[model samples]
Target: MSQVVLITGASSGIGKSIAEFLVTKGFTVYGTSRNPKQQEVNGVHFLALDVTKPETIATAMEQVLEKEARVDVLINNAGKGITGPLEEIPEEELRSIFETNYFGPLRVIKAVLPTMRKQGSGLIINVTSIAGYMGLPYRSAYSATKGALGLTTEALRMELKEFNIKLTNVAPGDFATNIAAGRYHAPLKQDSPYAANYGKSLALMDEHVDHGEDPQKMGEAVFAIINEKEPAVHYKVGAYMQKISVFLKGVLPSKVYERLLLNHYKL
Candidate 1:
């Protein structure tokens, strides 16, 4: 029997790519979206799911369980981005971003735990970003959510060790996706001091995204991990510079690393 895999945020981009790629390899893939009706792919079963909505997440998972009997892998790929200077961003807006990016995944993970615990083995992969490690100018809220998810994943790995449920956190560098366009940009006041720098930083950020690796590569990385008997706890998906930066983050001095980070954006 094929391993049953369920992925959230399957409507498009990396999520859709992963769903398609895995199904082609003979895995039973259930790809979810907020509106599954219009997000159909060739080989994925469309399930309506809005990660932020508890009822919808429960319903989607139930629909999958009824057919598949077991979900061997669960990939939490659904996320949204928010960008702005920390000072200008409202607390409420930041909370909403966390709702979608961090808490959203946590809810789904919690929902799946009971089922996975019963089965005695499972794999969980939460998609995060490089920004999780470094605070990006004009993208502080986005960074916070991802950073929170990263640490959550780390904790889950330790907690689930004895259960035979493997947890992996993937920190992907910019990929060619509509995430940038979908991201919320703070409504800057006409005379705000951040106006000029915001524009420059936003442009630089977009440049990294526009020039990021193809989303299909991310699917390949997922495939490699799924086939593993015991995958590593963390993965970095991007070009050499991006992956190397994850390494340099650990060995470089705190001040030196901070310098490289600021220099990357010419801050």
Candidate 2:
């Protein structure tokens, strides 16, 4: 039988692209959404899964396990986006994003571990973001969530190595998708101290998403990582500069790197 692959948040965007691509490659793909409009699409089976809800996560996994008997790969692609000045961002919203972006992935991983350990061979890929490498202005919440997930992936990789279960994080830069529409943006207050800089930064961020690289490129990247004999703990996919920014932060003086970010956002 083909490798059984389960992907969360597969109704659209990067998750959907990966799901469709894997189906074409002959993997038995089960793509999930909080509310799937159909039973299947492009040869990928649709399941109802909302990462933020533990009950839904459990139900989805149970359904997949019942049918497949073994899951070869688990893709934690479900996440939410939030942007605003750190001070202006509501505490509840900050926690909400973490629920979907960080804790949700952890829950899914826990749900699948037993089966993966039993099989003695499995791969778990967490879809993170390039922003996770550095905190972007007005996007601190999003960056923090992704950054936390990335770090968690690194730790989990080593802990699960002896079980023959491989784990890795794939951090993608901006990709053309509907993410901007779904992201939570703190209302731009005209009288707020951060009004000018925050407004400009928010516009720039949306424009970047509007013109981001094709989502299919991300699909291809994930496919390549899945085929690897021994994949690295982290993989980045995006524009050259976006990937290079991560490296620059490592080598440049802290103040110098901070200046570069300020200039980039024109803050």
Candidate 3:
């Protein structure tokens, strides 16, 4: 039997690409959106799932299990983007992003573990970001959320290994997606102290996303990971430079790396 795969945030962008690609590979794919307009999309079933909502997560899981009996793979891809000076971003917004990006995935994982444990084999992929590897100017909250998720996955992987279940983190760099349109931006206050630098950083982030790699590449990378018999706990998909930045951080002195980031962002 073909594996049953479930992906969150699959209405568009990277999630959509992954869902469509997996369908071609003969997996019974279920893609989810907060508001699904159709029951099927490009050979993938559409389910309504809001990661922040536990009831919706449970409902979606139940729907999938009722039809497929088991979900062989779970992709935690539903996440929101937030960018602003940490000092100026509202506390509520920070909490909201954490709910969507960090706690949301954890909630879904908890819901699925019982089913996977019964099956005795399964894989969970948490979609993180290259930004998670380091702090970025004006994107601190976004970085923190991903970083937290990544670290949690590291711990969970060991805990789940005994059950023959696998967990991994896939950190993608900026992709040409609609993420920018959905990202929350603190107002560019005319009198705010961070106006100038924050504005520059925000514009640069948008520019990167506008010209970033195709989402299909991410889809392909994920497909390969699913096929692997023994996958690593952490996988990074991005341009050479973006991947190298993480390596550089490890080798370079802390202050030097900080200066490099400052120069790159033109701060």
Candidate 4:
């Protein structure tokens, strides 16, 4: 029987690519997006989903379960990026980022766990970022969210092992995704300050994302992991920065690592 895989944030980027690849591999894929427009991708089904909304998740899962009795894989790929200096970011904006990037996956996982546990075998893939390991200048809010995800993935892996459910956290370096191009709302505050520096930081972030790795490549990496017999708890996918970030986190002192990131970002 073809395995059933459900991927969130499937309208574009890594999620879309993963869904496409899985379909080609003969898996029955249900891709989720906030937009209801039917995508004409071969061998995949698109379902309207908003990860931040529990009703959307419950409804989408019901649709998938109605079609396919079992869900073999759940890819928690729905996330957003909030780029700006930590001090400049408003509390509300920061909370929104956490709501989507962190809690969003949590919601989906809760919704899918019953089916997965009942089936006795399943894989949960969380698409995190290298920023999760180390903080970057001008991306404090984004980094915080991913960092929380990284830790959450680790804990989930340990907690879910006895249930025969696998949790894999994928930390990809900068990828060519619409996430960077997506609009970010600034944190609202009573007094406005650090506006000029925030603008400069956003410009720098844009330049970095424009030259990042391809999302399709990241998708390929994800496919490989899902097919493995003994999948790792964490998978780092990227060329330069992904490897370097892990190395620095392992060997360098905290202050030195911070300096290196500051210099790399030219902040």
How many clashes does each candidate structure show, in the order listed? 0, 0, 0, 0
What TM-score would you give candidate 4 relative to the actual structure? 0.93
Which residue ranges in model 3 land beyond 4 Å of their true spot? none
Clashing pairs in 3: none
Local accuracy of candidate 1 as per-residue lDDT tens digits, 1-267: 999998999888889888898988998898998887753568788899898899998998898889877889999999888888889888898889999999999999998988999999999999998888777788888888889999989888999999999999888898988888888888766688988777778888789889989998899999999888888878889878978887888999989998987787777
Q: What's the lDDT for all of these models?
A: 0.88, 0.94, 0.94, 0.83
Distance (Å) between predicted and true CA of 201, model 4? Answer: 3.1
The alpha-carbon RMSD values of the candidates against the true structure, listed in the order shown, are 1.4, 0.6, 0.6, 2.3
Q: What lDDT tens digits, residue by residue, belong to model 2 across residues 1-267?
A: 899999999999999999999998999999999999999999999999888889998998899999999899999999888999899999999999999999999999999999999999999999999999999999999999999999999999999999999999999999999999999999999999999999999999999999999999988998999999999988999999999999999999999999999999998
Cα distance off (Å), candidate 1, residue 182: 0.7
lDDT of 3 by residue, 1-267 (tens): 999999999999899999999999999999999999999978999999998889999999999999989989999999999988889999999999999999999999999999999999999999999999999989999999999999999999999999999999999998999999999999999799998998888889999999999999989999999999998989999788999999999999999999999999999
lDDT of 3 at 251: 100
Off by over 4 Å in 2: none
Candidate 2 is scored at a TM of 0.99
Residue pairs clashing in model 4 are none
lDDT value, residue 219 of candidate 2? 84
Judged by whole-model lDDT over C-alpha atoms, candidate 1 comes out at 0.88
- The TM-scores, one per candidate, come to 0.96, 0.99, 0.99, 0.93
